[model samples]
Target chain A: MISKEEAAQEAGWIERCQRGEQEAFAPLVERYRSAVFRVVYRVVRRRDEVEDIVQEVFIKAFTAIRSYNFQSSFQTWLSRIALNHCYDYLRRVRASHVTYFWQMSEEGQRNLEATAESREPGGLNAEQRAAVRELASQVLEAAPPADRVLLALKEIEGHSVEEIGEILDLKPSTVKVRLHRARKRLLKEVSSRARVRPGEPAGAPRP
Target chain B: MRCDHVLEILAEGDPRAREIKEHLAQCPACAARARAWRLAQAGFRELASEPVPEASVGFTPRLMRRLAESSRPAPAEQSFFEKVGRRFVYSTLMLALLALLALAVPRSGPLRSPNSAELMLMQPSVATLQDESVLNVDGLGSHWPHNSTVTAPAAGGQR
Candidate 1:
């Protein structure tokens, strides 16, 4: 697979693809598949669904490639497709009533607990582990869908704010404000939960 | 400005670091708020960063194969009118250019002759001389061209 930078350097490939040279698009697919997968996986959570969503994102990207102005990085463009697919999937799930928001919240909590249990053998003390688990669950639960998407792209996926803005079709200032708000909300939730729980000391060092 | 600047700078800090430093700061009210916000942020961040289960082992190969299939060339087709329309446009443009050039080029053909009435009408000064002579003479005999034929009429009488 070609590196994204190298694939991007082949400016002629986009033009060729626009001219209906489908073969010219393989390098683009190879370069962006992982990034697209990461975005979809972060939003959808299920491995099987992520695979399907990632494929759909690429297919959509190819079909719409002619309209792409190359104004943003290809990866940014691909991420938008991935994010939109996730949102669509979420909406479908909501409509079907397979899982409501509250149910997902409980599921997320359980997942956090499971993760915390798995992390117990990593030499962390009981109090530290509890704090970590608490913090993780609170952050996940409090973030809105858009904020969750941004957090995934910016923090976990390690995309720059500029890239995130391109993907979300927002200004960098907007992305920054949302990220700050998201972080602030998560912080408040975790700290309040910590104060109420008696097992851990208030000032316990983070694991 | 002081509080705003501090808060602005502090907003960019990692949640854990931000909270610890904010608590140590003198502003108890702001520090408490910052701590709360940071804790909430940390919680959310942790959940968001949870690793996904590894994809099925054959996933990459399958994806690559599908990508390869999608990139394969399909048949190409162009309609008859599409081809004709293109040629028509090209020929029309060429013809227009040729017509314009033909008009622009110098020519050596004979200059077309003028009609007799046109030649006479074009010399108004010549027509005026006849009018001036008629006014000066009381009889037409003075200016008439003759070979012993008709007599001229007097100014006031018919002859």
Candidate 2:
């Protein structure tokens, strides 16, 4: 949470930027870099793409700083930009036949290697964990971008309906509806693949 | 559980958040669906939480460079319509300003006057207007001498 003093400081930087001080944005970036990266990473899981998207988000925020209304906190406003870029990346990937991939950095590759070996609750084997990750990625890719975005924002990022609505330009009710549908779609996909019936434990064979 | 009931529970997220907890407590199917939904959410959240990447040390500089390039007067960044409209407006304004400038300012020394080229361009138009046919000052267009006592003709004079 940002303190009042911090928010005020942030507002000062934003006002400076809005007044045409382009470098004023650097301080703002320093302040919110981790937050914006975390929120964007929730939507775009590809480690290589995350940094590029984060940079694009800041570039966009800087370009559109003049249009930033102080209605919401700068964090909220920034999140909106990050999420929009994530959706655009998803759409571009969907529309293009050729894949746009970046070679993962050392940190990213190390983390991937680590997660590839990490096991979740229920003590799934390394192969099972990889399958889960692969299946999860596929579900995200298969679901509509909007749905996937709402799912990530709500379930993972824990944004409220109104906040998600503000970020995505949907009404609160629409956010709820969409998120619900997204959850159902993802659940359907997971269950279909795993054949896990209601009340049945995961990995159990279907009758 | 009903489909709407299940979705509402899923949307509620963490059935403990609302009275949905009581409903989930009573309905086994709703509870099962909730667990399933949670597992599904956890599935993706797991991947999302795998690792976060930060912008490199030079990210800000690169982004600022990109921003500057975009905001600078780059035609490729502008839309086709905008490019056409801007070009048209700019060309028209330049011509209009040049024409007005040529007529307003005297044709001073070529080396001294910045608008010398514009004045040169307007010279032909001025000469065309000065033609005897173009400037039909036919009525007593005589130059009256102010040095002498003779007064300039006030009434209409014979051609």
Candidate 3:
């Protein structure tokens, strides 16, 4: 983890870069690349596009580094840059008629579809597995956009609440509440589809 | 405590542990609920644990190159204005320090003049009377015509 003081010191390199001291920026890049890559990978998901997005994130960060006030850690600031790029890419993808599933290699697409199909909870028998897989795909297709994003970040990417908050610009408490609600909604959908009786809801209403 | 409340705490952990311990001391029903919630949470945790894919091998170098390219200096040389700006900042800072020192030090003192006679005359109680005849000898003395005795005002009088 980069400390506030360390980030501040690195900011001096940005000032140098602004003055045309290009070499000063190498260490800054080395320190923050992994943090930035993790954010981009979480959103974009595709291996090929991850590099392009990561590159774009650094370019954006370099162009805007002067405006950074050092209020947050450089890692947090870099994460925001990567996240914004990922969201922009997602939005662009959504606006176009292109389907991400279609863009993937056949094997990749098959694996992803397989995962989606078998997402149902509880151990299932052979017949039940097939039925549950079919139903899981339908439920996922029906899930809200925000819920899907939350699930991808929390469950698929395995991000901690604090990390998600930094990436999403949400408070930790808010992230927890949203994640808890997202899981409950997914659970409710699965339970409803299974026609299985729920013992009780997972958690109480958040104050 | 309500089962709902106990379940919420159990979902989060230690907070629910303490709550359950206290509730169990009195209410067996809520305590039982806590135990069930804990078991469920543990099971969910196990199911949720999946290995994330490793970051691609070339990611670091590719990122570094991108960052390097973005931070690269312009092909054109530094303009005269930029050079002047840097010098201006340094000069301004140095000048400010000098200005501060000038303001802090006492300006009036014996080091400023070779003659000590004026300093001796400025003593609080000393009254030096210069004869007008000495001024007449030193110069044509056209201003001493009225022979008025000019004396320093007494202490505390406005000059």
lDDT of 2 at A191: 55
Give the per-residue lDDT of model 1 (tens digit) for B69-145.
66655334545656878899999999999998777442211222123223324432332122323332333445655
Model 1, A1-207: lDDT tens per residue?
A: 456767556567788878876677776766666677767877666676777777777777777888888787666777787898777776677567654333224544444344332312244444444555455543553456666676667655667778788888999999888877765555455445444232332244446
Over A1-207, each residue of candidate 2 has an lDDT whose tens digit, in order, gives 888998888889999999877778888888888898898877777777788788889888988998898987788889888888888888888788434333334543343334322323245445545555665666666777788788778776777889889887779998877777787778776555544445532223336
Worst 10 residues of 1 chain A by lDDT: A112-121
Lowest summed lDDT over 10 consecutive residues: which window, candidate 2 chain B?
Answer: B150-159
For candidate 3, chain B by itself scores a TM value of: 0.29
Candidate 3: list runs displaced more than 4 Å.
A2-9, A18-22, A97-149, A152-163, A188-207, B1-159
Best by TM-score: 2
* CA error at residue B103 for candidate 3, angstroms: 85
Q: Which parts of model 1 have CA positions greater than 4 angstroms off?
A: A1-5, A8-13, A21-23, A94-138, A191-207, B1-11, B14-159
Judged by TM-score relative to the true structure, which candidate is superior, 2 or 3? 2
Best by lDDT: 2
Residue B136's C-alpha lDDT in candidate 1?
Answer: 29
Clashing pairs in 3: none
Ranked by TM-score, the better of candidates 1 and 3 is 1
